[model samples]
Target: MTRCRLCGSEAMASVVDLGATPPCESFLAADQLDQPEPAYPLHLRVCTDCWLAQIPPLITPEETFKEYAYFSSYSTSWVEHARTFVDDAAARLDLGTGAFVVEVASNDGYLLKHVVDRGIRCLGIEPSVNVGAAARDGGVPTLTEFLSPDTGSAVRAEHGPADLVVANNVYAHIPDVVGFTEGLRALVADDGWVSIEVQHLLTLIEENQYDTIYHEHFQYYTVASAIRALASGGLALVDVELLPTHGGSIRLWARPAEVAGEPSQQVVDVLAREKAAGLQELSGYTEFSARVAKVRRDLLKFLITAAERGETVVGYGAPGKGNTLLNHCGIRPDLLAYTVDRNPYKHGRFTPGTRVPILPPERIAADKPDYVLVLPWNLRAELTEQLSFVHEWGGRLVFPIPELSIVEVAS
Candidate 1:
């Protein structure tokens, strides 16, 4: 961390440290509970030179992604988001039967299935063995391998150059940002498009979404930094779209530098907005650590008060981000009881570091706790509607991010 991962600059400024936390997705099995668990420093720092916010590469991508527990299709809204993106991309890019599409880190073929349905050729390059197998079973042409420059060139040789390369929610995962960007450049045709969706650093700082900072996510991105990152591998940011996914995200539309003539007005406008927010300067990041501390204090206060009142407060969704919040707040099963998730893989497992049991989603309805503390608050709308049945038992949903708030959903 002495030198910035993205830029070779030694100038770094602190941006909230969550203390040492385990890899967020490393759920523990019952048998492994007695063994020693590992944790790493979960500190974020911003480069004054490049303005790319990053954590050190304490863990490798192989350790986390080889057998990933996260299956994208579990969330109905995210699947629909992927479907909508595919439809829009096909129409926008004029993708035909002969055209080719490729998605990197494509979990369970959620997005590429739409491309397959359109009779267009598509391939998914995924690193996780389990999820990649699921993608193949779902009729996607998937390669179970991480995307390096060589891997990208090999895929191109085998499947030909892709017309549209989709990389959603994965730009921040890689430690070798420049090499990964070059791999992306190798996969895409000279005239093709590359679409990437990542959580916006501007919104993250402004809205108090510090939970998204974890070892798995090596970097956070602003439009200004993102533009610089893209150019590392000869890609140009041609357009930009602000999205509400993952709390708040930016959809970066890029292409080969040769054909990427000029960026859209949207990109220009967003850059102006970022500049006004003081992201390029050190002003925006200096206060983030304090805000993050306030979040931890507020959440802990609420949970302790609930415990003292003799009211039960359980958690919903064992997402990776939730682990950060739980570990930072030092919440255990005593305060949270047990959390439930829709993913059966985690039903009998425990959250990494925090040894809270993960049970089935039905457990919430069966138990009818006084308050269901939602961990995946990014999926607020969909989860609220889905968990509204709790209202039948006079129960409510509590969201812990961007300040704690409780909602009484209509049954």
Candidate 2:
């Protein structure tokens, strides 16, 4: 009797199931190692009514984001991406000092810092205490609590409605997707716009990105699904932009009810394209389980062969996507000696489920393993360039998804 969170449809089918796994970001300290890691069912389902791809109800927001460990400033590309977003949003929305900008799940003030620099009033709603503190230190006013209808009303009572609300890569993390969007409607002014960026579900299936299936991500959205979800909260989609970040993503711009903006042709075109590709059809998600199985077999085989050959393998980027991949493939310290992450919070900790040690990138230079597995495959080019020194040891970079391959650095 599992119902769709968006459309209230009881008709749902299991699309892909990754089994039980630990919360992706729940990295553990050495002292905490003695405690057993809690795991939950990580299964995906498709709603027949709305065509929304999503995970079965399992964890809540309070459980997932409280005291979060991820800091966005650690990634160079993410920082630059935030900067570009601020610039583009400012110009597109004609925003200035008079306007107010609000970002939900504003991790470490990565994007708000730029908005504040332009003299615009910016507010951040971040549930993670440590990350919110970092955002405050970076000069962005942040509220450390989950965004809900009550919280949204309280924020509106104090600061009035916002001119722009930005939610980058956070739309999927919410358990009550309907309530979250209703809160967005309450916080935004009648004529104000809300922008949401999410990793596209179409891109995930096409690119073999089963790694993105984790408990933290409750929903995998397509434009059609998003349109339905937003309209349910009395919002309308006015524009859509395809972004290269996070492998492939869609940035959707929406406005409050009765407020109209020129709907972009890109929005119409993409919706039509998704329909043509069968995203709206029940059969579209039928083959996903098979695809996921193939990925698991391929990755496991590669890891087994590498271990047998005595090739030292290590992981790059302790991102949530990496956790899903590692846990699904049953990768442990035996297969991956350790993982390197730029985020200080994750450094010195061990990845959830896999329990592989996490260290700084400097470890790569010190250990010089025979192969470095790039987990954040979206940033393969950037990561490869950063670790080009592997060439000195005649080591090659390996990527398991899309396909397993060993790449040699050009001299």
Candidate 3:
């Protein structure tokens, strides 16, 4: 009888249960192996009242982000993405010299660095100690604590309300969605704007991207649900944009309820599409769970067949999504010799639950495995380009989820 975190609605339906899984990024230290790992039931539920998709009994932010290992600066595409966001936002908002830009959950100041370079006053609120230190090193003033109503009030009192507040891929991580959004209300100036980007639930279901289900990400959002959630916190959705990053994401621009701004056509169009697609109906939830089960079956069959044929398989991108997919499919080192990641912090560590060793991308060249399983399928194009040398050795790249396909190099 798990109730909805937002509306306290008991009329909820189970979407997909990922079974018990370790914290997606809890990469193990050598000494930590002696202790038993803790895994929780990863189940998703949808509320009929609010149409919000979330997990049962949310974990605390401190347990989720403190000493976080996932760094945004490691990925080249992510860095470019952040730069583009900073450039576009600064231009659109006319943010210049005296304007203050605040980024919530700013990992290592990836986007904030670009803001700082433009001679604007920028502040980053990061909960991760290691990441906050990195931001500090880059000369971005950072606050190392979770953003709450009290924290937001303190920031407003000290530095005054911000001109632009940016929260990229953080809307889903916060358990107290209403409180966090209310905090935004407290910290943003009357004329200020707040921008948030989250993985679109409509796209996740349509694309069968069940891999995005991890403990750190407690909720999935739709524009319809988001507008309602924000409105409850004294904000209004002013505009929305579809971004290609992270499979598919929705970038929403919001302002205080009293501030008048022209709502973008894109926002209206997307909302209509969501409603037409029955995003507010219970049937949409039913279809998503079925699609997810099919994905599990298809992926498992491919792995078992590959293993029987004596084909060597390895994985690419030790991302959190990849961790969920691996654990859900029950994939271990036996099925995957090792996985490669660009992040140095994860290179020597073993993936949670699976215990698959994460190696540097260079290892792929040395081993020359027959098949490389691309985990972060959203970045397939970028990863394939980097691992193009595999084609020279007659090896093919395998994409497991959504469908099983072997990408052969064009001669």
Candidate 4:
């Protein structure tokens, strides 16, 4: 009886099922490992009516985000990406000292810090108190609440409407697409800008990115689906830019529908591109399950081969995608050993389901593992550069998605 979250239709077709898996962000402590952990159905469905690829919420947002372990500031590439976005957006929007900028799900103020540096008025709405506290400590004013239609109206009333609203990588995470989009419409000024970045479904299906299908990501979006979700909430897509972050993502710019806004050629072209790619049809999603199964098989084969060769294979970055890949492939600690992450929060914890110990990045230099699996392959360039020293020991980097590959980095 699970209806489509966006269009409320019963005509949903199964796309790909990742099986039952734990929440990707739910890192476990050593002592907690003895206790039973619950896993829920990690399946994706495409609405035959609206063509929005989605998954039912296995766990509530309260359970997933209450004490979040993932912090946006942990990734150097992501922080730099945020800075670049702020620089470009500020310049293009002519944001000045008096302008207000608001970022939804502002994890640890990674983006708003740049806004504060420019002396522009900025506010951050983060649900997790832990991350929100970090934002406040970093000197960015943060409200520890989720962005719903109510919160958005209250924020706009209390602080005045924002000139720029940023919701990076959050559109897919929101289960109530209508509420979030409606809130977005209320948060931004009529003439202001709203930027939303979501992982593109076209890229996910094309690249065999089944690893991106975790409970935290409630839905996947095509440009057409994104338009439907936004239009229902009184917003119109005005522009879009495809980004390389998170495998492949699209940054959509929006304005209130009441405003006389015309979508840019970029928006028009991407919609056409999706249609040409057959994303407008259910047939596009039908074959994805078969592709995902092949990825799992290939990864296990590579891991088993490495183990047989007596090579020590460790992972770099215990990201959500990493958990999904590991859990889906049924990879245990025997396969990956341990993964290193820059974030200290996950340093002593274990990856959900796989139970792979998460160590510090320094462990790579000390252990000199034979191969390091770059889990967050979207940031492969950044990780490869940071761990390039692995080449000193003839170590190679492995990528698990889009088929497993051994990368030999030049020193």
Candidate 5:
């Protein structure tokens, strides 16, 4: 992007240029495989002024979320994480039956369902019609609408101001960062708390998590940049928590400017860490593009060697990040026979640009492939245990990110 989405600056520097790829989640149907698939330049640039790394918003949220293929409930670990967060938040915020909780971009009511179970008043603001319907079917009070300043105000008026506003893994999704933060401000009561969980730029750079960089994520944030972004919309960062989810993420605790005091020591420490890592300068990003190339080369070499040796290699989980890894490495069905996922929506469909078939999770066991390339490597521990049955066939699991590593799962 020529200008920063979070800050109005033209001093953008290169972080990594991933060439061109289609929307990461735009899986193809069998009949539409022949149709021309469009691709966009998937380059990431960091603004020197604000230190916010972002890609151009070539595609809108509606294009991707209207009928999303991903369902949060499919990931057991993620559901448990949500449940733990709800329980902790309720006890920490002293939320009782009279307290109200609101979650933005509440996919399938994964988190809010816990609030409902606790007898707390809660509402979910979901954008996708299908997933929103699924949430309602599960007994969640949901509003099928995008979060804008106007929408936030309307919701606040209709159902009173929220005592707790929880936005997990969505702070980086919106293109208009300032407006979205304002919407967050409008939804919460004056003294109410807001918690946002987003992938930390520090972890993405250190762990070589390039697959998470896509058009859907308009911007990536370091704690220093996040503080500035939050201040732009009159929300003050009060505290911070380091989380292990999504490889590594940060949970920001904020409040209205009038009520928010000085940030906690945790925020100060994380900002110091980001600064020490040289993220705000060009030093930290110089070797990233090279590292990304290594990941692509290493994965391809392993796949090609397996093919030449007459060994079979299949993939596990058809996540959006997997599509990025597939397209970046130019992997096809030949390199990866096919991938399997727990989500039925992706069954029988093909990956966006890679065009690899997506089969049911059962296919891996039935086919008895020699190796299972784990696509959603972020969930390595969880998937490794679930796919441990492959040990019966002496099949191993392969992880391509954070350096290619293969291990045998013991039965």
Candidate 6:
């Protein structure tokens, strides 16, 4: 009986139930471990009405981001991606000293720093206190508040409408899709554009990326669904770009509906591709749960076998998606002795449900576990390169998503 968050449709179909899972980003300190951790049902439903896939908002953003641990700056490729976007956007928008830029969910000012470096006026709207403080410390002005219609209007009134607004991988995290999109409309100038990047649902289903499902991420979007969501808030989609990040993502460029902008061929082409993939129909999502169930079984079988063979398994990168995969598989310290992360914030903590202790990357070499599970498979190449030295000791690397397989290093 879960209703769609976007369309207010009660005729939603169950996609996949990932069972009970703790908030993916809720990394725990040692002191709080003795108390019981709360877990919520992680289920995704597709609205037969709007074709939007979503989960109920079981947790609030204020609680989820209070002391956020995930910092975008920790990923080198991600930072470079942001810099490249800034360079291209600045040139494309013909931005000068007077032009203003704003970024929503601007974690740690990873992208806004480049804008400030270019001598442009920029402000970041971020709700996570730790990350907002980090952004301020790094010389980027930021407001630690969630973007809603009211906050967005206030920001526009105080700072003037933004010439360019960027929201990367944040659109899906919002529970109030309509309100968030309306906020985007409010924050941008009439002629200004808003760019949002989200993981393409086609890739999620076709590529078996069920690990991306978690409480923090409330919804998934296809080009059609995105257009519908934007249109609900008086925005028009004018352009689109497909990116390889997060397995596959679509960067949507939108402008206020009142201002006419020619829709880019890329947008039409992507929409066509979505249609060809049957994104407009219910069957496109109904079959995904079966595929996801297979992946879950395969992963559990692999882990159980590894344990039976007396193999010491550990994990690399304690990402939000990693927590989902581990919690979905019901993995605990018994299956994964510990996980390592480069981020110091997560080093001494434990993952939410599985309670897998997170240690520094140096610990991977110190323990030399028989196998290293690359939980963040999206960065497999980068992680494999960093952990290549493990091969010297006959330790293997494994990726559980898409399919569970051992990473074969180039000979």
Q: Assess candidate 5 and give its TM-score to the true structure.
A: 0.99
- Compare candidates 5 and 6 on lDDT and give the better one: 5
Candidate 4 residues lying further than 4 Å off, grouped into runs, are: none
Give per-residue lDDT, candidate 6, residue 387. 87
Q: Higher-lDDT candidate among 4 and 5?
A: 5
Global CA lDDT of candidate 5, please? 0.93
Candidate 5 residue pairs in backbone clash: none
Candidate 3 lDDT over 50-91, as tens digits, reads 999998654677987888888888878888999999999989
User: Which candidate ranks first by lDDT, i.e. highest?
Assistant: 1
Write out the backbone clash pairs for model 6. Answer: none
Candidate 6 — what's its lDDT? 0.90
Per-residue lDDT for 176-261 in model 5, tens only? Answer: 89989999999999999999999999999999999999878889989889999999888999999999999999999999999999
Q: What lDDT tens digits, residue by residue, belong to model 2 across residues 1-411?
A: 288888888988888888899989889898888899899988888888888888866777788788888888888888899999899989999998999999999989999999989999989999998899999998999999888889889999999999999989889999788889988998999989999999998888877888888888989999999999898888999999988888889999999869856678999999888887778886677787787788778878877898999989998889988999899889999989999998878888999988999999899889989989999898887888898999999888888877776899654
1-411: candidate 1 lDDT, tens digit per residue: 899977799999998888999999999999999999999999999999999999999999999999999999999999999999998998999999999999999999999998999999999999999999999999999999999999999999999999999999999999999999999999999899999999999999999999999999999999999999999999999999999999999999999999998899999999999999999998988898998999999999999999999999999999999999999999999999999999999999999999999999898888989999999999999999999899999999999989889998997
Instruction: Kindly report which residue stretches of model 5 are placed more than 4 angstroms away from their true locations once superposed.
Output: none
Error of 2 at 257 (Å): 2.2
TM for candidate 4 is 0.98
TM-score of 3: 0.97
For lDDT, candidate 2 versus 4, the one ahead is: 4
Query: What's the lDDT for candidate 4?
Result: 0.91
Model 6 over residues 146-246: C-alpha lDDT tens digits?
99999999999999999999999899999889999999999999999899999999899889999999988889999889989999888999999999899
Q: Where is model 3 more than 4 Å wrong at Cα? A: none
The TM-score measured for candidate 2 stands at 0.97
